[model samples]
Target chain A: MTTLLTDPATTGAHRADTTHPSVSPADAVRQTMTMAWRATLKMRRNGEQFFDVTIQPILFTAMFAFIFGGAIAGDVGSYLPLMIPGILAQTTLTACMATGVQLREDMDKGVFDRFKSLPIARIAPLAGPMVADLLRYGIAATLTFLMGLLMGYRPGGGVLGVIAGAVLAMIAGWSLAWVFAWVGTIGRSAQGVQGISMMIMFPLTFLSNAFVPVETLPGWLAAFVQVNPVSHVVSAIRDLANTGTLTAEVGWALAACAIVVAIFAPLSVAAFRRRM
Target chain B: MYAVTTSPTPPTTSAVRTEGLVKAFGGRRAVDGIDLEVFPGEIFGVLGPNGAGKTTVLRMLATLLAIDEGRAEIFGVDVRERPHVVRQLIGLTGQYASVDENLTATENLVLFGRLQGLRRADARGTAARLLDRFGLGDAASRPISQFSGGMRRRLDLAASLITRPPLIFLDEPTTGLDPRTRGQMWDTIRELVDDGATVLLTTQYLDEADQLADRIAVIDAGRKVAEGTPDELKSSVGDSSLHLLLADPTQLAAAAETVRRQLGGEPVLTPERGRITVPLERADRAADVLTALRTAGISLSSMSVQKPSLDEVFLALTGHDTHSETQETAA
Candidate 1:
């Protein structure tokens, strides 16, 4: 055989002696960040992707706060503390659903076929976009708070507490996105992924205490709401944003987020590997 | 340019070698028990009609799909057991342009370069150099959405070459190109082999295989039917064949008889359409067959003589037409 390229960057054949040295955990993380950069570029080019994150949060925060303000709580000002955090959690989680839809859409493209053929980590394709999707959650969380501030709702817990709440919600959204990313890998088509993601997302968001108090529901339903992971996230956000303090609920929400990621991360990776 | 003695890996006899490689989708074997041996620095062509599982074979070897049975090795490395090593040893450009559509051409290349383990700065440098080499310098920063099909293909190929793997898999590299672009792609592929890269390309175009491949394997229904040099294959199918569309399909049987009796050759017949393709030893011999058919009152609607199509090659090698098999698969 003829000698291959002399350039060090192109000496792929020369490195063949290193048998089965799969990409290290560190390399996988680096590759995943590179993929996230790609996803960010896609998000920048497709501005329509931000419609849900930007507009939905603003609209939901205003509409839900005013419409249910009197019925759920005493008045609009009192409801602001409870409803604003609820809106933050709701918008962030909804934005998380887009992660799966976009993943499905991206995977449907021919570029993904090339990604699959590359020598990169299998998790790179699935996790990269989810990592970048933290931005969508960030935007949603911020917009919800901004909208709340505009509507005469003040955070008693101050700037630090508000930031913490937003950060927690962003983390929760990123973690839950693993569930949808899993759906993206297993779903038959992009539309199918969106449909399944919504079916899962809507129930998780609406059945929780995002817009209404869980105690008002029947005893059995209240028990389910207490266990609902989204309720914990919303409660945790409220505790931080209104009281400016960490509570057991915040710890519970963080643990729940970690559990979701731990369970679904492997599932998403395995599904992505088996997609073809 | 010939300063070549610092090789790290042992020299192998073949660039790509596979034995009884099988891939089944559900219950149907898309690539069943196929064997291939492609030497280094040669353009090995996988020629088949649509749905012949040519892409499936490429995907399996590229580690995009799992092999259902049998063994495949790239440059002496097992494909299934160690895909990471095999991936490092080869470059795969799929049937469609595989470059990211959302990014500009330069960004896409740099992305792949970084994915190839190049640092950020080196990835940028390599992207610029590859763009210049592929004649895509002018469109380097344009988003891939603005690219022509041929340009996207070039960029896709450039992405694969970032690591300069010894073996390259190109699945129908010029299937949808204009003739001018197809010629350009053919020149590019030839350039790869000259630079010590082995290429395995698949196509449904017999003319493409003739012009490019050092050796050709003709497959049908997931099984390889014939493998030989282009000259050996052409000798069986002939240089050109007369395609006659009969006025009345019912008289096809009679027309086949007249051609056989006059030319002493077998004809490929489509009974439903009353079409007959008769291989010719020379173009001048078309007169004899036409004269014989007219005398037998087997009037023709239209006729032309041209190079043998893949269908003709299939008929000559498999003794059955490819049109029926492709229709059955409906790909």
Candidate 2:
């Protein structure tokens, strides 16, 4: 076989104006957004799986509210505002695991290997998947709240308070996604990621006061529950929904969210940088 | 600019060059001290076996993996210093189809073009042009999962070429395809080279390397054993082979040992089949070998002399057959 070598002089003259084509930070951000959007679009094509987020949240929220509202509190009204926020927080965070699982799937299927070879942003694949996952969490959180409202769980918090509760939950979901992304990057397979993520999340969600008050627990358990980040977030949401109050606890919960993002965002990017 | 010619003149602006690249995983070296110079519009083949570190070399060249030692340059830009610049001038298609199976072929191509910074309309145009070029126009709307292996491979290749990158890395581009599809892919690759695009190809198929490579580099166990044109490497080990098949199944081992003792090299035993093969440098060596066999009373079922293949050259240099190992791993 004969391969014709192009005239370097011609290419040099043509590329002189181009100089060095480098991926600027702004371009990296744009590429990340584009990659994330593409990933979400692919997920939407199936359309069947979207119901997992939209319908699961609504069904789980309403079922948990009705089932627990009577047995635990003996009255539905007494727990509507309290339980809705807890359910919303719990449901959204659980949905965040899908982000890591999907990433593991992509890696196993060699999608990231392809991206590594392309002239795109270094963090596009990692950042893009995280960004796209926000949409899933957002949809799940919104549907849960709407179902709560339809079932007569009027948030004592006004629209602003309701938005604040949702915003906190959204940020919590997004921040938590970074941790899962890191796990997914290092985990061997999607099944391994699922097992590890579930193990990590089960303790966090169940140990926190998602279903009951922390004071009712044993002294040692209460100490663990109080320090748990999920408890802070749940308490913050409960405060917003039940009394529409932005207490010091809520401020602390926001700090915790920032802290998780601070730690895991860079870690996820660094881990993802080597995944290819 | 499009119709280039093969010339010995070194390009003043090389598309990509490597100097003593080295990479290792968990203390096992994959690419060790390989030097390559890829000029614009040339298809340079890195021909090696399954674990010869071809993919590692390609990955490092594409800036996917970091260099452990030495330097790599892409379009005059230092790869270690400005990886983004190196990435901009290159495209890569891995051994497997890397398309998102959930998306349609058209969607996959358009998305890739968009990632390359093409405008929405231009991305779509590029997608359409590529689909048409690869005979995937009609199936553009179908999800990639629904396509056959050949169709998926075509889409995969098309997606890589979306930006018309000046340099491309195609790692085992035609593995697992039927002969007809493989030929189609060859034509497509030739078209790219003809259009003044430089390509660096890596393959285990000797024919693939011979059919496409302007210069071939044969690697063994993370090191380059020999590097030259196909003819040069084949002729280096001579052009003939002498194969002996023992009539008595029990005598096969003795014959092989006898051949090894006479030839001063270990003869290859085709597993489970009763045959021993050795490289022949001259035709008269066959007569000498036959005389020795008669004196030793080694009976043969069949004996023949034929031209040496690239496989023989590979075995002569590496002491292992590439096909048998890959078949074992695949099984």
Candidate 1 per-residue C-alpha lDDT over A19-78 given as tens digits, one digit per residue, 9 for 90 to 100: 344777877888899999998998998999899999998888778878899888988888
- Per-prediction TM-score, chain B alone: 0.79, 0.76
Alpha carbon deviation, residue A248, candidate 1 (Å) = 1.4
B232-290: candidate 1 lDDT, tens digit per residue: 89887767878899998999989999889878889999999889998778888999888
Per-residue lDDT of candidate 2, residues B66-182 (tens digit):
888989887666788777656666778878787888889988988887777777788888889899999999999998878988898898889887766677789899989999999
lDDT of 2 by residue, A1-276 (tens): 001123332552133224334566876888898888887886777576476678787887777777888876677777677677778777777777778888888877756677877767667887787787778777876887788888887888877888788888888888887778888888988999999999978888889888777877999999999888888899998888667899987988888888988998788778877664
- Relative to the true structure, candidate 2 has a C-alpha RMSD (angstroms) of 7.8
After TM-score superposition, the amount by which residue B78's alpha carbon in candidate 1 deviates from its true location, in angstroms, is: 1.3
Give the candidate number with the greatest lDDT.
1
Worst window of 10 by summed lDDT in candidate 2 chain A: A1-10
